[model samples]
Target: MRSVPEWAQQRGFGIRVEWGRAGAVAIGAGAAGVVVIDVLSFTTSVSVATAAGTAVFPYRWRDGTARSFAAERGAALAVGRREVSVAQPWSLSPAAIRRAPFTERLVLPSPNGSAIAASVEGTPVVAACLRNYSAVADWLLQQGWGTPARPIAIVAAGEQWPGTETVRPALEDWLGAGALAAALLDRGIDTPSPEAYSAASTFTALPDTPGLLRTSASGRELISGGFPDDVDLAVDLDADNTVPVLENGAFTDHGR
Candidate 1:
């Protein structure tokens, strides 16, 4: 793959939106901050844990090292959805985090959102979901981001195919990215790149966000996979106030 062209960076725009890891690298360049969206679960789970006053450590690989990564921090390692048991209840599922016994620190691993969040450096990284888009946008604006001088990059952590590295841009994440874009616009930060505008418009033009989320490909996957509560929590729009900001390799609430 070639490097993303200069024009494709959404340069000069106050708000930019892009898909997958490559998009994050492209738009993230020169931006003041990056907001990662994975509405199906990852970011939603971050919101749940952060709101509970827990710090989340985002890990890219789910291999054997994840356990050691958690162990080094004295944090609980999140298990697979079906792997959650009485001894290890924390998983990527938002509902699972909500029900799990409280822990001050947690290591959450994923190839999608967590990968994007953990990999981004230099600028601040924020975890945003439908549950706390408003708070995120508000926090960004408060920090003087989303301006011509300090642009904001919003990356939608699209899903990957079962056995491939190809990105499957999920509708839920697209809309989740748009939700924050729209909130930025509503808060008087009106300059969005064309891609960001399209995402924000898609969000505002929708009549039933909850319905759409419930029926999205990723959403349905969770429902059929016996984790409907996660989907339910992801659709809880503006339901939270905690904004998880990546600092020192962990997402700690920028508690407003």
Candidate 2:
């Protein structure tokens, strides 16, 4: 019953995966749904917020715009990880935000994940991290989204240095994407793209994910920045079953 154009677009893809902004636009164009995985924090934060029954608004990390953006939405802007405190209600740290007093809505800004998420045009976008990869995969399967005829694009929202346009793929996100890809494979979805297969293979080959994540570059950076707890929280694979899906400009728990 679907229109020709819509069906054509869905049939054009078969489990493609890519990194950062380019993937947000290019791969999102044809895929049935796009999954944005930013394990260092953004997607992880979204998973935590949605798990707590809150909606999260994605915003690009601009110094002055975030406040006004949140104000316009009648939501609070989440602070940086280091800015989180006992009195601070929200922050980029997933562990911290998970414990904060629950708010109905929040605007979370990031240079990578949030930016790519906010920029995605028409495709349904889902946030994924190690904590909720299996949950997301199960949700996708329930939605019948990972079929061979209607593939998904799993995007790793890699980190970008300030004042630069280029982004470097983070190992954490690569593994996060791989984890989701592997989950889909377990459900009988075949990956046509070698990139997706490689990512899944990389994740499956890891024997001690949590131990390894502690030594990742992003993990070390977070630890050095006073968020050692966040790295530990990020590697808690399948810790949650909430799938945060972006809808009407904010991420809310799927099927809610």
Cα lDDT of all candidates, in order?
0.93, 0.85
- Clash count (model 1, backbone only): 0
Single out the weakest 10-residue window by summed lDDT for candidate 1.
Answer: 1-10
Q: Write the per-residue lDDT of candidate 2 for residues 1-256, one digit (tens) a residue.
A: 1233443232344777888887666566657889999998999999989998999999988478898998899997898876777666698888888779998989999989999899888889999999999889889888788755667888899887667878988899999999999998898887447788899999999999888888988888898888888898899999888899999999999843
After superposition, which runs of candidate 2 have C-alpha atoms over 4 Å from their true positions? 1-13, 85-87
**lDDT string, candidate 1, 85-135, tens digits:** 999999998999999999999999999999999888798999999999999
Instruction: Report the alpha-carbon TM-score of model 2 versus the true structure.
Output: 0.91
Q: What's the distance in Å from true for residue 256, model 1? A: 1.4
Give candidate 1 misplaced runs (Cα > 4 Å).
none
Give the distance in Å from residue 231's predicted Cα in candidate 1 to where it truly belongs.
Answer: 0.5
